[model samples]
Target: MNDMLRQIEPLIPALRRYARTLLRDRAGADDLVQDCLERAVNHWSQRRDDNPRAWIFTILHNLAITRLRSSASRPRHIAIDDAQEETFARAPSQEDGLRYRELLEAVARLPEDQKSVLLLATVEGLSYAETAGVLGVPIGTVMSRLSRARERLLKERDGDRGAQPVAQLRRVK
Candidate 1:
């Protein structure tokens, strides 16, 4: 329906971003989004109206998990072109760009559960309740995972900053 299209159209970019973060491959992410959209359209009648965004995200999250599990044993390959394009899309400043890439690498190193919670809550700006609904986890669980994710990232950033003990100075000279 036109109404459904209008509502779903606006969410495509966010869905794609989440998918790319989860899968770490643009083509796979795009395919996942397409599959999610198809599934959403097919199940629109059954979806509750109270929280369509959560519902849609739930669908995409579930699909992404499934895809990840299925592909866990396979080796991943990235096209050089895609890699170059992504590299060119970052911030112009070398320092900012390096920091951004490091942050993304830190995120990628996170456990799946924590990564999902972090992305849903922070990157997508979903509330705890909404993130909980999308991930089908308790709010407390979401909070715990998010806390761990944040702490881990902070530690990583600190480590990258070369945190070290300062030499003690003599009391008098």
Candidate 2:
């Protein structure tokens, strides 16, 4: 019990980083991380020998999927703080800031599956097998999704923002 807690403690920063990347909203990311921690602590005894990082990540991923899937069915209220002061260490140059913002927008625009696969494998530094375990997909599928995600981000960064996104085709026979 204490061992599990100690192990999970070190993962807090990594979990928060992954959650923030997965969810752009700060409050939502914090909520997700909190929920993941709760679940981990609750199931610690049952999962004593398993990989704690993977277990927590899987829980977090599942929770995010459920919320994202149901979001359209519910109305969400967002509170904006108009007077919030922005703070940063060594603020980036204007061009750098613009590029960073563009990268975020591109990642946000990716399909949910591709985005998850990319963020988990790259940003979270998870192996293909580990990402597959988290997402409950085959390793090959994870690889394909990650590859596609990288390609899409590259295309978006190179192309004009005003260009229309390619549409998926549906066949009606």
Candidate 3:
């Protein structure tokens, strides 16, 4: 319906921006938005009268959350597309590239819930409240998980298996 289109039309860019922040890839984010739009069109009859924007956003947010969770569970592998630009930029040797790949793999090994919360909060720049709304959790839970995720990422980045204090390294290895 024209009414539905008009309401959702303005929200597309916002949806895409949020999705891009969540997925960290423009194409993946756009695809997620398209899927959300398709679902909205298909289920238009079921939508309630109030706050169509929130409803549509909830759908998109859920889809992105689900996707991030699933991606976290898969076998940890560095994304080729993600690495290509960095590879070209650095002109690193094969050995250095392998080290970078290992770092990515370690990040992938983190708990899915932590990864999702961190990405939603830090990468997407969502408010704690917004992340909680998107993730169906309390704001406190989001904050705690974000803290844990940062800690875990720091440990992995340092290759420190113990709870030792991490020293800041100015140079990239």
Of the candidates numbered 2 and 3, which has the greater TM-score value? 2
Clashes in predicted model 2: 0
The best candidate by TM-score is 1
lDDT against true structure, model 1: 0.92
Ranking by TM-score: 1, 2, 3
Q: Per-residue CA lDDT of candidate 1, range 23-79, in tens? A: 888889999999999999999999976458999999999999999998998987666
Model 2 Cα lDDT, one tens digit per residue, 10-64? 8888888888887776778899999989988887776634577877889888888
TM-score for all models, in order of appearance: 0.85, 0.81, 0.53
Candidate 1's error at 71, in angstroms? 0.9
Global lDDT scores for all candidate models: 0.92, 0.83, 0.76
Would you list the clashing residue pairs of candidate 1? none
RMSD each, Å: 3.8, 8.4, 8.7
Candidate of highest lDDT? 1
* Best of the two (1, 3) by lDDT: 1
Ranking of all candidate structures by their lDDT, best first = 1, 2, 3
